[model samples]
Target: MSDWKVTHSPSAGRRPRALSPLREHLRDTFWFAPATAMVGVFLVWAVASEIDTRIVEALQDRGDYDAVEELLKVADDARTVVTTVSSAMMTFIGVVFSISLVAVQMASGQFSPRVVRIFVRSRITKATFAVFLATFLLTLLVLTAYDSDPDPRLVTSVPLVQSLVTLVMVALSLLLFVMYVNTTLRLMRVGHVIDRIVGEAFGAVALLPVGASAEGHALGPETDWIAHEGRAGVLRDVNIARLVRVARQHDVVLRLIPRTGDFVVPGTPVLAVHGGRVPPYRALRYSVSVGVERTFHQDLGFGLRQLSDIALRALSPAVNDPTTAVQALDRIVQFLAALAPRPLDASLHRDRRGAVRLVQPVPGWAALVDLGFAEIRGCAVGHPQVTRRLLAGLDDLALLVPEERREPLLRHRALLAQAVERGVPEASDRTFALRPDRQGIG
Candidate 1:
């Protein structure tokens, strides 16, 4: 019912073998960017300080009094600028991130909690944080290089290059601040959020392996079910290549016991080994990645789940916003129309020997159709705009999808008609609601 929290007894886990919990951790957290930035800032300051020393020595050896005096004056101004930048940066970080968090919270509340991950994975947000911290740290390093003595003879060499670099970092941080605020504002808009979710869905669909369902039936009886170990959470993704390679090595087929977005508990059977020597438990566990919440990394249905959540929230009595629900439905229609033509069946991973090593169960067309519309239709009973949009969405999908996949679409269309007939007492309203309008009315 909630976004990506549905648990299926046995379904596919997918993605490349290179991804792991650590990688996911870095992607989902804010620390990695800032930490990397700090380290980079230190290295840049060290190199720049060395270069400044070299530049100053070269100028003095040439006895260029004019250039040396100019450099000293620039160095003095740089020190003052660096001190001011360093002092203001901490406050800037606090104020900027504080406002950002509040805005993010408001957006999450207005949309769905799953939306938070989008902001977390946002390149702008990460870059903003990285630049801000880099500017602050670079300034600090530059301040440390300033000589205490005002005398030019005792000053040794001025940190001309370091100061310039620090100033550049400050300018970059300010520029990113503007961009960060703009991105945060866009995140709050429902239309923008839906578009982003749809974009992620398309990206996920591109990575999914398309094939016939016959392979799912070709697998032999399961010899053993491998129990999950360690902490409990949602099965975010699996290292499919590794699983296939391991299965091939053991002369068996490994089928994931749960889908990528399904919540998995410790001691649960995470994999089903079909007819061969059992592979090592450690290898199996290592290939599976779990997290506290579902991610778009591999979960194809997660996008639909998020869109559905937004629609559901909009239709709720607390919000009672039909226009928002219609917007959400607009995206839902777009997503399904794009997905309707794709092969929605289980895919088989085979070894070099032409034997099936892994079987991944993808969601059937009917299931996806149901996930996208069934709940919205039920909640849309009283709202004519949403009801009309549902009808229009179903009509759009009916035209785009192949005949074999149109049965569910037709069935949903009938269900919507029936719901409108019962929910709307007026004959005219029922007729209007049943009429297909892509914009829900106009």
Candidate 2:
């Protein structure tokens, strides 16, 4: 039998390669989109101003009194419209985003705080803000272009195109406001949040390379260890290709000691150098990204962590909402089912000559299964809905996952049974909990 077999998964395909630190950090921020929109608005003003000037010159030269009169009338109307828009746009933007921020705060409180990143990274949120700011800036620029002298005949140019563009921008901003409200409302819903988390998790999974052996390729005994030399935080994503190139250059094998999502302190041993001189510590450190908290960029377990956190919060006695916990379990089972058949082995990055340059640790089937199910199972003690759903989830995974991979599911299944028996006093309730129902009580 082949040592490493990669079964096709629904997410099986070419995954995205590691993103540069700059791109990854920017992806998680809210400023870049609006900043870019402002710059683009400036460029648009420049072009529209030039076009308007040319159109006016042509009309004046052609001795078309009627056309010049119409253009001047449009410019007069546009000044009033642009003035109004510039005055109201900032207030509109402030109110909309303030409401959005409140909604996002409530969502973070309702679910997990980690979910705030979703809003920060939302394209709708970014695009809406960008368009709103763009409209405001564009209108202000158009207002400045209007002449101090009011006489239409004496004016060198009428900003006809700028006026039209500003009006169009106002209409677009109003349209996006409706879209932004709808998106923000959906973000508050538990089902939508859970599904989004799962979707993002799949995206992270798609970045991992496939067809690696289950038994990880062995790098010989390490000669030196590279300690982390930065502020303590979670190890996010590493530039695998860059590290591999560095290793290949120095004829060494470098093994990343901490997995993605693992926290590293300044002195934490982050890498192990084997079979050659250690590459520069700065070079190795620079190749990896450490951040304040976990992100979905390359950390598969972070998704599971978010789902579990929501479930645990739901199961808390303070919340007493088993239904929400069941919802969380629904997505958890979905993620695990999709993950069950895929390769969960250490990823080996190699050079062109087939030499292993870097070895990275990946969560195996058991670790992921546990990450998805463990804590919730512990907290699910007295909640029948959550217990039934947990049992059902494990049973489903047991059937779907291969026999060898079913051990963790079976172990959790037995643990669930014992917990149910102890937590449910009456025999009938115990039996009911033991019997699996995909929809919890249903």
Candidate 3:
């Protein structure tokens, strides 16, 4: 029997909505969040300055200039201070950007190039940039409210409150700068990166529903294959809810051809509608979103791919960092443990009447196991530490999963033993590599 079986049957459909393009774009872009915060900060500072200026004017009109006399005395110095700080902040922004870019470049070189996405999408980095820009904007707005010209009747009043607020903003920005540096350093750590990827993978597994069985029901004879008509990219997400609605309306069973994270070229078969009535092509096309790269939003494989990439890169001759590969394997084991008990292949979306509408493709248990460990085992040929770690990970998974799920691990273990025996000519080295130890020491 084939290790991975893809069963095609009408299933109880899930109602997951497709991700909007705007939302997905905003999540990937580094500037949107910070830019929005900057606009908000500018408006807030403008309002506060106007309010402070009005209070001072009201006091002067009421012959109560003494209330703001201290502010008027230092008006000239306050304007100079705000101007200098704003100018200095502009220079500071440039420096922060330069340092951030350098750090990203270094991370990309040290890790896989795709890992740079994690740093760019970091919330701490975006918040730090927003705070710095907000402070600069606040300073400029407050500078406009400060008046150096002395009025003969003392009619002009300085914005004491606004100036103090600008100073506070500067203090906040400095504190955030310190925190941003700490965050950047933490992100560079291999353990932290692996943990992050593992966490996301676990979360994705949890989100997937344990689907009902579709054993007896077979697909209809009449089937219409839907072909993709655009540039090639990874199938990031499918609009399950929308697809279900379309299938129900047309009374057809829509079977997704390419699973999430699969690369589809133009004119590739994407969907198979098993019914007499054909659905609108545009509706079907727009329901699925293709992107330049795979994302963790719904594609669980992408998460595994990331960890696998890190492990492979570490095992490469240029890097040859066995410890890093071991760390990635540790996380991959955790992810597999989380997915062991779940029904991964049968995704069924039903309508209000409880009829199976759409069936989407998902990776089977054996497939996931292969994806998580196969390449790493292939690369661990000469490295005892990585070989032992892979054995240990497989052993741990065997103990955690059910009997039916244990066969793959057991088979892979034999393969690992063969590879180790071949790679290490000495009997003692082979024994050590075959032993299941976290550190690969007998």
Expressed as tens digits, the lDDT of each residue in 259-301 for candidate 3 is 8889999999998877656798766767878889877766778
| lDDT for 172 (candidate 1) | 86
TM-score of each: 0.91, 0.92, 0.88
Model 3 C-alpha RMSD vs. true structure (Å) is 3.7
CA deviation > 4 Å runs, candidate 1: 1-17, 20-25, 59-70, 151-154, 209-217, 351-355
In the order shown, what is each candidate's alpha-carbon RMSD?
A: 4.7, 3.5, 3.7
Candidate ranking under TM-score, highest first, comes to: 2, 1, 3
Model 3 worst lDDT window (10 residues): 1-10
In order, candidate lDDTs are 0.80, 0.83, 0.78
Residues 1-442 of candidate 1: C-alpha lDDT, one tens digit per residue: 1111111112234333454545765888878998998998899888998998787778777777578777788888777878888899899899888988998899888889999999998989999999888898888788888766665544567898898888788788888889988988888899899999998788667755443222334575668778888689998888777887788788887887788888888899888888776798777767888888888776788999999999999999988989989999998888877777566655566665566677666677899899999999999988888888888888888888878889999999988888888889999988877877778766
Better-scoring candidate (TM-score), 2 or 3: 2
CA lDDT, candidate 2, residue 437: 88
Task: Please give the lDDT score at residue 157 for candidate 2.
Answer: 73
Q: Candidate 2, clashing residue pairs? A: none
